[model samples]
Target: MRIAHTCANCGHDLSRLCALIDPVYGLPIVVCPRCREAVVRTSIPVRTRARQARRLVVSLAMLAFSVLLTTGFAGAVIGLSSVVFEQWVRAQRNSAAPWTHEGFVVAAAVWAGLALTAGVWTGAMLAHWRWWLVLPAWVAMLFGLIFFVEVQQVVEFIAQGEEIDVLALATGVVQGHSGTSRVLIASLVPFGLGYAVGLPIGAFTRRSAARRMWRRRRRIRLHRRNA
Candidate 1:
């Protein structure tokens, strides 16, 4: 008969994370404040498979919601931004890579949704070393995608009435790609590294804060005893 309290959103250790209520459920549910995905108690007696299934459901839902919000918001923003940069964006379309096209907004939304869903599912199910699966996949996919596009771009540049040599263009793309991959690796590495780096940071912060509160309480007791 033991259940620990937690946030309803992020699954972050609610010992330091804030709690929110599920308005419909009328329960003191915890949730990720930013994404609003539920944070539930995971130490249930359910089988490992059951837990994985549950995580998949929640993660997929989160991804769907993310797509809705991102597309809806981005559409609004793009509409507004179009007034300022539509010409520039349209001008670049011929030279831009296919992935960078304006018309692929829906596809962008779908891809983002898939990535978020996969990442969140991996995070919840593989709370341990499993998080690495998602980050590495994301990094690998990003690079693979960019490499494919760069190759196509060079081909297109050559096909058109352009003076750029295809081989030289490809060589430049490879060099440019090296830098982009490094940036992605750097950005995504933190999430994979978070388990090790985050634990000590979170523990020390929580412990130090608790100690100060304990001292304050003890001082109040001492003052009463003296009086």
Candidate 2:
């Protein structure tokens, strides 16, 4: 399916114009025969540009919503798992049992799973974007949240009249003092990996579905013609 090109000024169909270099501008343009308006090769109609802008805004909104939703879900799962693990530990207090980091492992797994799911959903929803671009943006958004938290901590420390060590602050952020920070750091790789894997899957699935529908429509048209 292709969009029909028309003159921006006079709305004359310019689809059939012979590609020519405009003498005045020395640029490739299609001269609309009816209005004699030269539509530059690089010029997009206002309507098409507006539509693209709307799509971009929608894609960003969807991406943000997905991230927030995933973050909340992951937090809830980790909190519940932690509570359950604490209860189990109390129950086993009578016996001489070794302490296990099972709760941390479970939380990490939950974060990774949620991140992967979010990546897949985002890739599918914004399949028009290049995977390379999408992956970096997605990872940056995750890390950006962590950075914001770190900055807040730094500000709090300053407010308390504590001397700040840049190296220590950086190390702490990297080591993750908070659960949210840890989850974001741990899921960084998984989120990017999932998005890289999902892009091709999503694109292929969308294309195949479109192709099938096109074939079906063609077949129906042929049947009608025969009838």
State residue 3's C-alpha deviation in candidate 2, in Å. Answer: 24
Q: Please provide the root mean square deviation of candidate 2 (C-alpha atoms, Å).
A: 12.2
Worst 10 residues of 2 by lDDT: 76-85
Instruction: Give me the runs in candidate 2 sitting further than 4 Å from their true place.
Output: 1-105, 125-141, 160-162, 175-193, 204-227
lDDT (CA) per prediction: 0.50, 0.63
Query: How many residue pairs clash per model?
Result: 9, 0
Q: After best superposition, candidate 1 residue 141: deviation in angstroms?
A: 1.1
Which lDDT tens digits does candidate 1 get at residues 46-112?
5546867987999799788855653443333223323224433454667775456655454434433
Q: Identify the leading candidate in terms of TM-score.
A: 2
Q: Spell out the clash pairs found in candidate 1.
A: 7-30, 8-30, 8-31, 8-39, 9-30, 9-31, 9-32, 9-39, 10-32
Against the true structure, what is each candidate's TM-score? 0.27, 0.40
Against the true structure, candidate 1 reaches a TM-score of: 0.27
